[model samples]
Target: MHRIRLLTLILCAALAATLLTSVTARADAHPRETGRTVSGPGTPRAEVGLDPATGTPTLAVTRQGRTVLEPSPLGIVTERADLSTGLTLTGRTDREINEHYTTAAGKDRTRSVRMHEARFRFRSTATGARLDLTVRVSRDGVAYRYTLPATSGNVLGETSAFTLPGDAAAWLGAYRKDNENLFNGYGATAAPTGEYMMQGLFRTGSGDGADYALIAESDLSGSYAAAHLTHTAGSPTYGIKLWDGTPIQTSGTGTLTTPWRAVITGDLATVTQSTFTDDLAPASRVRDTSWIKPGKALWTWLAGGRAAGQSLEMQKGYVDYAAARHWPYTVVDAGWYFDPAQWDVTDPDWQQNSWIPELVRYGRERGVGIHVWIHHRDLDTPEEREQWLPTLEKWGVKGVKIDFMDSESQATFQWYDQILAATAAHHLLVNFHGSTIPKGLQRTWPQVMSFEGVNGEEKKTNTPQHLATLPFTRNVLGSMDFTPGAFHKPDRPNAGSDAGELGLTVLYESGIQNLSGKPGSYDARPVARTFLEQLPNAWDETRLLAGAPGESAVEARRSGSRWFIGGTYAGAARTAAVPLTIGHGTWLVETVTDTPAGLVRTPHVVRGGATLSVDVVANGGFAAVACRWYAGRTDC
Candidate 1:
């Protein structure tokens, strides 16, 4: 045993050394370019020059070799490289992007420019990786991105491409794939609207191969936004459509700076590991704020008892319940202001409703915050949106949950940026629902508290399978507002049990967590109430314990001296033993919250002096506690 322990220590040290060397080598390879004309107005044009030996292409801007954008072959397989065999690469120069001018509409004038861009197409074979890279100059700005076609035969996956930007916390956006109503559920079509971002794509299959794409876009300051429109997705879809019938599966964001870093691997563990080791650096500002106060846990009242009408009595009851249990906030979903039929931002009676002021005062007195819901369509017109901001602020609303931002056009993309900024200016928190996945936006605008771009609790009733499938695919991007903690059973018997709802509080990660059932539900479950009291919605440090896409996941989070861990399973029953390790201090066992059974009190024990392990079950998970031990431990 002693020899084995020594050997394990040596192996860990060696692995750490290798990782450091690789990171150092990468940093040394690419020194930041001193002075280059990266941004300016000119006739938009793009050209690609290939390096024959490496088979890598170099992107040139403005007919000069000023900035060399190099992309490596991502999904290369052992198959022969042919027109349609392996991943095929091609480039096109389109004049549509260069024609930019202004158009007049009556007395007002609007900018109308033909977007100039280049296209790179990647076609995958039965056994290899394929990718397409495109650079375009659009009216909004310039963009250099990539796309992976949905193939019929084998799958193609790609990774390890890098981008250089002026700053680490640059603006990034993604739209959810809008073709769900068309494809239903065959091959990556028609996923839940509120899940995964539209831009990032990840593919997996049983036929020994997978197809995927990694796209990166930068605004070049104020120059132009780039474009990379791949295959026409058959008809006019509501959101950004990338393929004919295929839908996007998974997506996320990471840092791209002087070292030029980003990597996408197959499984969840590999992806997290690569992101931490290769992509993540010492962020100038660590955004976790558990130190100031324990992050507040919220109870979302969207699909609960208030689904029908916006009743002040109903909202007051929910707030009273959350306040009784000490939960922080309660969210009043959409349909509260105008009639769902004639929903409009410019409506005079929008903020004139009686329930608005009633619920606000009721919540404030009881130490609870009220969050109002708004849709993206209502905020599309900038002038109109500005009018509503003051009203929301005057109402003393703590936050606003904006929904339905499902477009990837430059105009819609810019709209998202403006809304976040405006919300921040009002000193109000924002939660983007029915929107795209987050791309480090939380780091830039901390007030943009949470986002719902994952297939969350709403679909659990219709599609039971998605409840288990989403954590592995969509949850990795960032903090996912899954609207967890539902306390009701399915309407039908033998469909499944509703007992698994408690597991989600631990399973999902969000700065603003929503307990998704009526307040009465919490009154019935003593175990859940206890767990909610102890759980920390935000964290100081977060670690991926164990996981694989569409399988199972285990995560550990720390806020100050206390540590909490959560594990979950998608389809099948699974088990994972997680070690309790956070920093180098000694820890003591506190409590373990399990399923319907209840919490178990254990004797205090010391760890970090030794490795600790926890075991979990499938479709089910566990949340355990470990805190710093100051002196000799005793029985709890």
Candidate 2:
């Protein structure tokens, strides 16, 4: 009887200890499992949990019961620990954020942002290293990032990936430093094994053409390099692949905050009109942005005027053209300071040059600003910028087009911030060329007018499908320096119609619309000039009325009381019925359409909410101007 009692006591003690260990483990892994699901302001939902089979952290998003993103993997890969697996969710927190602000450029003037945020803190069970995964879900999309504890370590890469539905359609572009790769359509599972650059758009549902998700990143500071997406053969997952560079290191003091790996979701209109990319970025760092003006400019490079390198006569002609058209600026492109006689001596003391200051003075007199191009290598460091930027500002140069950066590494990203800060100090606007896609930096620095990261007119291989894909993919992120409107130029053979070329002026949103046509080209096309004269670089409101990724695109933008509609179609000919949702009023409509004879302009009147039907030919386009009809006169 003593032996039996002793055995029973030992067994009971063992059972009690096992139960306590199990309870403690569960509590450490999921302290607040009940708050795993987060719902946005609308139908968007983000569910965070561990994969039962793999024991890895997972994130899934949905809209109106439709899966916008499949259960995607989420974790960080550090040098000292494998945080992707063997992780324990030590804690969790939730909150809501609401903000309203005005923007200097891009899709909307006034932005209202509301987001539901959740932070999941985890500890590596093996190494005991801590990481916090923060997620924010807005009405239009979902974004998340990893935050590491202040420890001296190197972040190798991310294990986070975007898993697409098997049947989803994707429009993606190959990774390029200039981001000038061509976008092509493909099945989600068949995405190229190579790599794809940012702002990729995917169609989640085939029904109603309403569901879409744009994959992008925001707040990409200097701590980490920009990453692209890579797919495995036959897999629906696109994993993160960082650019070749040094691993992100922490100094054991300040916490390392990674960029937000964002996936924007909703209907086509929601995807196109969404400022969620800008919403995810930091607020404007330049407090006094009043001097940062957005307007149209004349670019002489594409017009073969670069051959007249530094010629005062050639520049004055272009400046006079800008002044005549009421345009705000003229860009003096490359070769402005190149000593043609001494081709080897590339870097010269441009301040001592006579023509640049004269051109600046001449442009200022005619209400036109001069923007000069400088190679990124020339103004690379802080010392170089301090020496050159102040002199350029003193010379009355309004903005600088910094070109040939050609990098997306950590160092390059840091360089971009430094340059923007330096230019803001000098009160000069900026346009970035040979650069990565806009990671919502324009919102932080309003002086950053646009980025030449698209296969714009500079590339002759651009097609109608490429043009149609832009409003959905690239332009949605921010201003695109497309350098459009080069109609009737023999050397510049556009694949789309002349009317389509005209439509680009309104469709692509660039803070500075560098018109590519020379003076004679615009003079030759009167109808195109008429449309350009009224086009505004910045808009009060913008809407994607009707379209699809590659098949077609129609957009409407408003500036004050006037509204402009632009449409482009690929593949077969179709009559686009665009809903003019410019509020209640009689609108005086003037449209530039492609006809059997040539480009034609017609005038009529229509009530608001009426459908403006346009017959777009295969690879053709059209543009229209609508103003409130007040007592037989238009309020334009």
Candidate 3:
């Protein structure tokens, strides 16, 4: 029996050793077979690895043992060479980036970030052109950009593509020059064939129920035109589509670089919390951002009720409304500078509509600033900008809302840079209307208050589902000028509960929070009035407590010691579980939600870490504020 047992043990040891050798051999050969890889630092590790199966450089990303981004093609196509295929890796370098940064406008004010970056240098076997592909992997996402020799000839476009899983669910917006389209969900295979905007968020359903990938671009410069995604029916791959024009001429010295193509991944919380796009953006160029202040503004374009036109009397009345609500600015929208009949800036009688100076003076005395509007056609040329910008400054105009710049060509981006610089020089805030989606330009020019790249309250398309989707998609990129607060009946044509409209002030983050409701409308509801009065335009901290794109969204934000929570739901009536994890303390919780009678405010007391059951009606919303409660009075 002893002899037999010893023989069995020896046989088992040898078999185990053989299996270990086989596994070791496979692990050792992985780099040579699959190419190079760099992994992010944290739980649910994220890795970007090169695939060289087709003798061309391709990239794939995986997190927590699931594919976030499948093997997709990568290269820059220029007139001199088709560098998309037949590439050989020549050299590679890896590094770690760990830093902390702050932003003037975003979901949160500060961020501490760490990422793993790798530069894989490849030589095109076809033309011998060297292409440097830089891949950076953060804890929650991945970003990459391409760099090529300037002499590579005129750049036609790129071959970079994203191939998602066919089973994955995607929320996409069709391409629009102004980026004012609504998002709709579709299967990756069933996605419509056409150009899509910068943002497209996908759900991988990777068991943890939080796996998502958001496609976006960052650090856009004037030298390169912005890119949109082009999809073909029945295919899961989306390729890069440039503006409708000829190839960009090869100029300048050294190397030409493309903007960072970023994919924010992970669960909903990680996707919302990841500031990777802004992290990839260039650092701020403004020396003194103190003059750039963020606050609420009264806009008279959409929700002015009877007083819609931009006459001097109407402007002063809106300014009075802004002052009464403690809102700092009132935007006198279009028709302010041009003649009502001609709508021309060069009209000899344009100077006749010159109550702007008097209105500015009137607003200044009452502690309200005025922002005038101008048509982009009238302000595109350098000569026109120089002529009108200084005159508006001389009139003490606080800002300019320039509209109808509905293109993202290279020249248009150059114009944007020029206008931002000119406005900065004059210390004038800028709100771009009918513009492309923001790509972290606010960091470079702090004076840029907002961008109307969304189908906001100005349109009846601001449905509940659309509003619920913005936070996870477009608003995640940067400040969105959603122009919330359409509480009145006739203006609120879309299907949403009154509480949802009130909650938008907290749900959307804009440097200039444009309040669109009339004075009488807000006066009737003291609860909403008081809520708006205390809400801050900027936040010290933000969290996506519980949310899913399109279906529902619930967020909690902090401004100093007080915590504000907003929830928006679509589809059907349900109770949302809001976990009050503000801190360990007794607190006073005041909630504004829709009841059968109307919008009402309710207050209660609860300890930290307790869950608050918020009943959100179908296609409705809710807003709440929590503060430390002590003695007989609330700390808030």
Candidate 4:
């Protein structure tokens, strides 16, 4: 029986995520199952106990008595919520969830894992409705969500909470204005009212060393709004708070299922690499995904200056440069439409419409695709947007960058979905700027290539610390458009080094790596040119070599047979090691390292697993590229 079960699990793991939507949407109130305790039967065990006294449920996780996650508060409640006084467990079920799926976007990959799931149904003695809390456990960590049947009051919001140890500090930054802030150290209890955005990392120390777990939401497709973390008073640790705008989201709605709130537990490395986001999300909804290609796009905004500004000639120069460098796409930013000097006035109709096609034709001749930039509210009506957007296909445009949509309301949330759907229909990829944190939307709609949710290089106030925090925070949510490549930014305030900027290119992930830097930045060095021009937009495997959340880090990412390694630092000089494991072919290695004098490049080769040492100065960088068969190959 055991062998047969193992074989069945292996076969199940080979397919994409296919399962019945368990705990189906319903309206009836579940009966109370007070004083019941259930243990998750798995390697990393999770035990949940319902307290009849307080009418609330608490969760505790352990690996052979080693506490992975301390007892934490677990439930969902809205503004009109309070069944805690009469909360009672009604039904309990223990089952196994075995599923697999292929990644549709972002770092392309596959997931095949098994886990145990426990569902606890409860009745609100006061509200007279049933609510269910469903939890999943595996080797990585635990994830759970609250399901409110229609019988309950209009479920508008959730205070879904997670309480951690007081001694432990969170790898959190400010939720800031638009979640574009850098993360740093803050005690789980010390975090002010609210500062952390999606995927908060909490690190704790026990007898041996430290443990890490990431907190965030996944599969936030339907009526759910984005979830943020806050400093709350009542807990063994910290709390998870979901932010809502005017006219509360999911309010008085039909059967409401909140996004999957997760606790990814392990070391900082395991916690960072866990596939909790894509793993919990559903498979691709679009059947035809051949047109969605993630690649590098040359952007004009970075080169837009008064001299030789956004004129047609300047755009042509950028196109020729992009084509010469082998970049796949070129972006005509906002300046192409409205005069930058006077935002209210528009360029001539011919310049806006006809010039675009002319530029597209110029680019098409040289094998470069064009992407147009548009504002969110410009083409508000269906007639305007539907008319203006599809016309791009005729001009050989590959995508559109929709900007300034700083909204999180239910209306705006749904509108985002609509824009993706519409663009996909037009066979154009999409990017959202001034946007919110991602929730696995790219995987669902691969055409929705990327978004700008980070405090990227455009801000003069951004520093190396800010970039350090991104990997664990904003980037963990999904592909972020923190346009990098400001190689000459040291002249400005709070600027990181040029070498650091190069490292950032390999660190940040996006379907369209629409970077912001001088057009001639990488032209001086053949090594720089080779690295930038040949960089793959997506990767098959990635390794987070060494990192301390918001401090210093190193990463090695692989696309096909090539490997790209980058290291970054903050405040002080540090040494990072790239653990290289090579086989199957001989390789050529090119490196760019930072020094007090300036940046330098060197070439070498290696046969097997050896740690490549990198010395990074304060706010500096280290980048290297290794590929088999690229030594004498022109295609490289």
Best by TM-score: 2
For lDDT, the strongest prediction is: 2
Model 3 deviation from the true structure expressed as Cα RMSD, one decimal place: 9.5
Instruction: Tell me how far candidate 2 lies from the true structure as C-alpha RMSD in angstroms.
Output: 7.9
After superposing candidate 4, which stretches have Cα over 4 Å from the reference? 1-44, 78-81, 206-208, 232-236, 244-253, 305-309, 339-352, 379-381, 491-496, 581-588, 596-598, 628-636
Candidate 3: which stretches are off by over 4 Å? 1-35, 43-53, 206-209, 305-309, 340-353, 489-496
lDDT of 2 by residue, 166-203 (tens): 88889999888789987889998887687888778888
Residues 229-346 of candidate 1 have per-residue lDDT tens digits of 2221221111222223222222213211111112232333433321211112122132432222213545545435445236777777777777877877877875576565444435
The C-alpha stretches of model 2 lying farther than 4 A from their native spots are 1-34, 52-54, 340-350, 489-496, 634-636
Total colliding residue pairs, candidate 1 = 21
Q: Please, what are the lDDT tens digits per residue for candidate 3 over residues 65-142? A: 787778887888888887787787777666788878776766778887788777777787767888888888888788
TM-score, structure 2 vs. true? 0.92
C-alpha-based local distance difference test score of model 2: 0.84
Quote each prediction's TM-score. 0.59, 0.92, 0.90, 0.85
Ranking, TM-score, top scorer first: 2, 3, 4, 1
What is the lDDT of every predicted structure here?
0.47, 0.84, 0.81, 0.69
Question: Which candidate would rank higher by lDDT, 1 or 2?
Answer: 2
User: Which regions of candidate 1 fall more than 4 Å away from where they truly are?
Assistant: 1-49, 53-270, 273-297, 300-309, 339-350, 461-473, 491-500, 571-575, 583-586, 590-606, 609-618, 629-636
